[model samples]
Target chain A: MKRDLALLLGILLALLAALLLWALHATLALEPGPRLAELASARLEQTGVSNPVTAVLLNYRAYDTLLELAVLLAALLGIWSLGPAPAGYQRSGPALAALVDWIVPLAILAGGYMLWVGGHAPGGAFQAGALLGAAGVILRLSGEPSAGLPGEPAQRWLVVLGAGVFALVGGGLLASGFGFLTYPPGQAKWLILLIESAATVAIGVTLTAAYVGGRPGSGTAHNGTGQSRTVQR
Target chain B: MADLLILPVLVPLLGGLLATALPVRSALVGTLAALATSLSGLSITLLVWLHGDLGTVLGGWGVPLGIGLSADGLSAALLAMASLVALAISIYAGSYFAGSAQARHFWPLWLLLWSALNGVFLAADLFNLYVMLELLGLSAAALGALTGKREAIAANLRYLLVGLLGSLTYLLGVALLYTAYGTLDIGLLGERLGPTPIAATALALMVSGLALKTALFPLHFWLPPAHANAPAPVSAALSALVVKASFYLILRLWTELFAPITDIGAATLLGLLGAGAVLWGSWRALRAQRLKLLAAYSTVAQIGYLFLFFPLLASLPPGTARDDLFAACVLMALTHGFAKAGFFLAAGLVQQKAGHDRISELGGVAQRMPATTFSIALAGSALVGLPPSGSFIGKWVLMRGAFETGQWWWLPVTVLGTLLAAAYVFRVLSRAFGLEPTPLQFVTNARTEIPALLLAFASVALLGLAAGPVWAVLGFGAAPA
Candidate 1:
């Protein structure tokens, strides 16, 4: 009886505390301050980029993209080193292949739209590329002969090339007495767009590679072929 | 300039995505990931120190509409510590699981962890911080599940569930703040926040949510089982990094926002619970059969020491008292980070050699694995706050600070925690001395023992090194307590 009474008291105290906090919040009349919706449009004008979000992702926050590249490349290399195992010997079913036939094109279209519209919309390189990568995985899982990642050499070159181009372009700007990754005053738009395009390819390929663990043509691929698991971006 | 803050987080994330794509040589991918992350950490630490606070004008839109990443001194320090431990763990793990099947994905998960940790530290905006924290929780759970045992899977699932609940509560707090205040940037919130009822409620919600995430006893149901069952490197990272990050935020919020009200009565409540955790955890650790469980329980006890600072510091009025108070907290953080990481690594070596971490059967194990044994002992010494270790100095400062401020109760709590630590350390060490009547034989490879020894030695020498620049670095620039 004592224990039960104590428990009830504890519960009541908790309820009282909750009610008190709620009352405090109600009396204070809190609200979200400001939403910088106009700044996105304004930034597009300043950077001369059609999509402010894209400009931000590829230009303003390019370092994040850079580190992301490092992660993908690292995963790819790890999978590459461990390839040619018996685990990569599974065959995909015909039904899955048929599904990929339709889904792949749609995925590509959506990915492209996301990249293009990211300047003003909610989607960007990361989301679009991830969706495209999902399509690639679907094709591979569905038994498409070339559904998987490309050869190691080609994949490595592609991954490096994206970072290479960004770095090289940025390096030139550095040489011009600005700084690393500084887009020239008037050319920020095109430079930003160009970087996003490369990132799209790199991001798409990277996500796909992480899932597939290398391309189909690249000697028995190793990585991603574990006891099948679903992946998310 | 602000954008650079986000790069450290993004690079590993992108790399994690690409690591899945890499064919063959998956370990190499993980190695590269570690390299990239370490580089990012080092550069960011240097940059932040050289310049000042770093933040991102995310999405070409500043805070409110778009997210942002920021690194102040606190974030930089935590980032540096996380990077160092991750680098060490990666090196040790490289050879530890060299030919294992999961090595391919190990690097990917690790990179994911790296990104999550960095993101959590750099996140300037509230929503982003919540997202990063969730990512960290999920990835940590996934990493724990990698061992592929029924126990590991179950523990990880439980951890995930509890972690999600914590995150949900924290998210709700964020919503409340958004509903109450206008901004999410911690700095902006600090400036805009008045001592209003709504603001106070928001603070309460946020603190409680973070406290739950940090697992301050009563709420720490998910920590021990999950931490004990995980693989060595994973356990080390989780204990030394993941939980600490949440606490880091709590500390930040306290120093930044709640300093005024904390002196009233709320801080005392937290300290009281902390005192309980110290006793409960130490008592459990002394009685645990498994080395891993012992270590996990020790973490509970160690965490108690961190909370003691709040009440102790708040009791002090302004001036040098505050400076010493904050310094003690920082020292405590640094020492715990190193010592716990070393302890976990040592425990890993023991488990690998014996095939089980059962303490009773570990007799005469020290004969073969002296390095690992030494490492464990040194780490244990630090954990116990024994003389000549970083932990000793940290505890001494804290004790003195407490006494100077008239918080005499902390003395008993600290002393009791120390005694319990000593008892447990001796329990492990005495068993290692071949005194057990039913002693079981053991042998361990040198490869595993070296990293453990290095980390342990580092913990021991940490205090000595601090006399130089590291000591100066302690209070280089800060608002004191």
Candidate 2:
């Protein structure tokens, strides 16, 4: 009976939503116009990037992107707070190690290429960062724990690099009489590249660290239970 | 001055980044950063209040393209309230988590949550609000689950998932809105909006999603568990500021973006659900076994009172009477923010002394902490809508508005909720007056006790007697026909 009632309620809600959607379809101007696309393209030259999407993400709506990085950082902080990173993956067999050795550097090179091409093409910080993170994943799979990542102290700084640099550059712009995230007219391209480089590195570290799933020392403990530190009572 | 609007968001974010990087010095850095951030936020609010609304398209990109941040009377007032409460929470947290291993984790997340709260209040772009909402949810859930207890982690996992679903639904609505209007700016959409099926669907998706976040009745199932299971400071912030951010968005949407499309029938439906929340939440709160659980349920009830204003807002024509009701709604929400934070802080201390918050066994602990007990009493009176409290003023205006609109049925519900609130508050306070030897001094630790007392005192003394400024700050003049 309880399940039936819930089902009934769900159905009723769905029907209500459908009806509302139907009403909106009938009365609203539901057009698929290229509103932002057109606007971005028009303002693309001034925004200091060739790709309209890049212009939008890095310039026109950079504030959202800035906060997005913060969101990523916040998630990592939450995970770290829970416990230390688990111990490194078990040592891979020699065959897998050979494969990882070949794959990882190629991934890094590809990530660098993606970062460089992001200014005028379909590559940017996030894409490049994802490539770098993939390399870390390969290292982890091959049982090279730490996933090619640094220790806890260094990892902390690496994780913050994206948001820290973004904020610093934003503040720098504001100090120079430009609005926050507003690159000066002629300097937009270089600044964008500089910010993207930092973001790519930060994102790569954060993704890999998250995959590592605990503080650096967590995996070192032979027992399943990680060390728990208690603050002063 | 338009540029100052970004400071509230930037300062805490920078602080969070700094704390995240410098793990060894996070506590000291986090505290100083929180203090600086709150002071700067308060100053920005004052600047806007004195100078009128300030808005700027970020990166100098015009509307329809760039995201914008605006600080009007509404945003400014809430920003000021949030900052003050956050400052108190930061100070309380400093001592609460002192020397704990988790302290490093707490500061960065707390600062991030602070930044998100400011971001939500100040965001003028729809998609921007989505990003801010997601940030707020992640940080809040993480903070809420800091205790590492089985129940705390489980409850927060559910919270995190629920928050994700709500944001995704809200994002769908934003997508629909952008498709229809070609812009995500609130003002631009408001100017272009018309009553249509797509608009209706957008409104439903957005409002329902926000209602879930706000923990409105029927959708509020996730709230109490999450609120009650969190650490005390986290509980305070969750109840006082985080949940209210969602409701603020709902109010902003209903009055501004959806005004043209909002129907009286829809408003009445919301009012009915609110009534259900008030009655049901109060009853649950009254019967709750744990102190924090009771506080959490009371949060549910208080949120209902805020929603009761919607029907009145829809019924009344645009004029002073409507404006008065609007201001009163904001006043009630602000009062609850202060009152609830004070109650939770005091409750935390009491629990610390007793080692548990089982209300029936709190007698010995209650008698010892006279200052903490006093804080609860004051905050409780405000919660119960006793006279000389801001909630008293808020409830008065609410009831009067109901009468004027001839919606007299709401009065009985309001009265019953108030009485139930009073009963539960006194039930807890009754423990304090027992025959155990009481402390001769009113205060025990000024560091901890002062923040709670000051918040409770402001809810009653400052807000109740000096509410004229709220009206002026909202830019509403004396009532006009």
Candidate 3:
């Protein structure tokens, strides 16, 4: 009875929240996005940045993008620094290899298409990255660590690409003639496309680096006991 | 200016990232990360003081597009106190985790907690602030339960539930406001919100939810055990910073979101709860025999000083001689923040040194460690509102204003709380000085005393700093002085 009551209450609360959200949308007279956002978003059309959402995520909301990239970097560093369960590495396969082979190429193709289609519609670099990351995770589960920690220079370059590139663009915009991240009046779409492409590459690699940092025997071993966080998972 | 504003978050986050990435132990990296974060926070706060309001736009974002972070006089003062307290606690935590195998879990959560703290301070948007608050609540709960004992787990579970409930309530209110006004940006919301029923209800829900999290007297049932049962460094962090952050939000949101809903009855109700918290917390603290429990209860008392700002809101309205109430509350929060962290650190040291923290058995313990005693006494002095401590200056201004404004009732409550604080603070100190027949030989580090001393000295110096800058940054409808 108690369990059922809790379930019922939770559902009620969720429904109420949904109703509230609907009412809010109705009352706030919520419009499509905003004119400025729409105007800025149009930059994707000219730039040819494969993924529009990725372009928006990486360029339009680049500040948050930079931070999110940092979070990914932090996660990777967390695995490396904390050291992990010794020999926690395992590669699993069954009929899985055959299935994975069939899915992997299709995923990549879909991801690439999504990346290309993002300019005109909802797809973009982030969706491509997610699909790519999913492939990486599957690969890791199949024995490979999914990515390699390159030389210090490569690592440093990759890590700073998001913030560094954003800064360079904004600084250049201000330094040249436009304000900040502003294009040459008519070339907003092309400039935005450039920024988005770089952002996608930077975000993808950084996230991969962070994700791979969690594997066993990579550096997490004998890392002091201070880095653990038990989320009751 | 942007560098200063962003460093507080950047250093910790970078340190946290590095700590995770470093080939060394994650726990050690976390401590180093915390140390780096505190040092950065300290320098940033100092920079804010020197440069004037430190403002930064993330990826150069601003207004409605990108996020903006500003550290004015008020944030600088509070942040200075917070960072110093966090730094000392971090050092104490160093000794704490060295022997424990569980250190790895400590750094990530600690770093995350630090990140959340920085996030709250630097957040410029309402939704961003909500996200940071949620992060803070989650990290604090995880930290609380790190000990994994049944009681600790239970305490942490309760804390997590309460925290999530509070956040949900706050979110619910925010959603209502968004429905009513169509924006989640604080600056935008303020301009949009006027004398509307929706706005009034939103403020009520937000404040009540915040008050629950702040552990204001009626809603303070969850704090004592949660703080008391956690590991010492964790305890210090939770009691000194976690609860206060929620209050800081309340104060910030009060000025930003609820400025228009200036209700007299509501103000009195909040003040009444605050006054009750003072008497109730101090009373319970006096009864607690366990040193840490006693210190934990004292936190409840300190929290009351924050709410005194509500009632005095009118007296300190614009075009006035800065209602001394505002100064009083900020002073009280800052003083409590430092002195309480010091007290917890010292209490932890005592527990470590004596094998237990029995107040009665602490006799003659002070003779062997004068530095620790000096720390406790100094921290206690601040708690008692004695001269040469920040709380003294805060209470002095508050008392002066209370009488001058002819609201004499608050004066008694302030003095009463001061007396009660003195009683409890001195009680522990006096016990430490006892000439008992037996002296326990528990192991303690000489370095342990430093964190407590740092906190004590900070509280002492804060008393001497000029207040003009402090109020200027509060900027609660007032322009920078």
Worst 10 residues of 2 chain B by lDDT: B434-443
Give the per-residue lDDT digits (tens) of candidate 3, residues A115-168. 667777787767766776666556545555534335433654565455455546
What TM-score is obtained by chain A of candidate 3? 0.61
Q: What are the interface RMSDs of all the models?
A: 7.0, 2.2, 6.1
Question: What C-alpha lDDT, on a 0 to 100 scale, does residue B60 get in candidate 1?
Answer: 40
**Candidate 1 runs further than 4 Å off:** A1-32, A38-41, A47-111, A114-233, B1-20, B32-73, B258-263, B436-447, B464-471, B474-481
Pick the winner on DockQ between candidates 2 and 3. 2
RMSD to native for every prediction?
Answer: 6.2, 3.3, 6.1
* Off by more than 4 A, model 2: A1-34, A218-233, B439-443, B478-481
Give the DockQ ranking, best first: 2, 1, 3
> Which lDDT tens digits does candidate 1 get at residues B29-143?
7777788788888788778767867775454445554456677767877787777778878887887777876665576677777887888888767766776677677777777
lDDT values, one for every candidate = 0.70, 0.88, 0.68
Give per-candidate clash totals: 43, 14, 25
Give residue B317's error in model 2 in angstroms.
0.7
lDDT of 2 by residue, B1-481 (tens): 6877788999999999889888779889999999999998899788876888889888888787888899887888788889999899889888888888778889999999999999999999999999999999999999999998989999999999999999988998887887677889998988888896677788989998999898999888999999999988899999999999999999999998999999778998899889989988999999999999999999999999998989989999998899999999999999999999999999999888889999888876888788899999999999999978889988999999999999888899899999999999988888766667766754388878889888888888877888887787788985221
Which candidate number would show the highest DockQ if scored against the true structure?
Answer: 2
The deviation in Å at residue B17 for candidate 1 is: 5.5
Candidate 1 chain B: 10-residue stretch with minimal lDDT: B467-476
Candidate 1, residue B128: Cα displacement in angstroms equals 3.5
**Worst 10-residue lDDT window, candidate 3 chain B:** B472-481
Question: What's the residue-level lDDT of A17 in candidate 2?
Answer: 74
Error of 1 at A3 (Å): 19
Off by over 4 Å in 3: A1-56, A65-93, A100-120, A123-233, B2-4, B23-56, B59-61, B99-109, B148-150, B179-183, B319-321, B364-367, B399-416, B437-446, B464-481
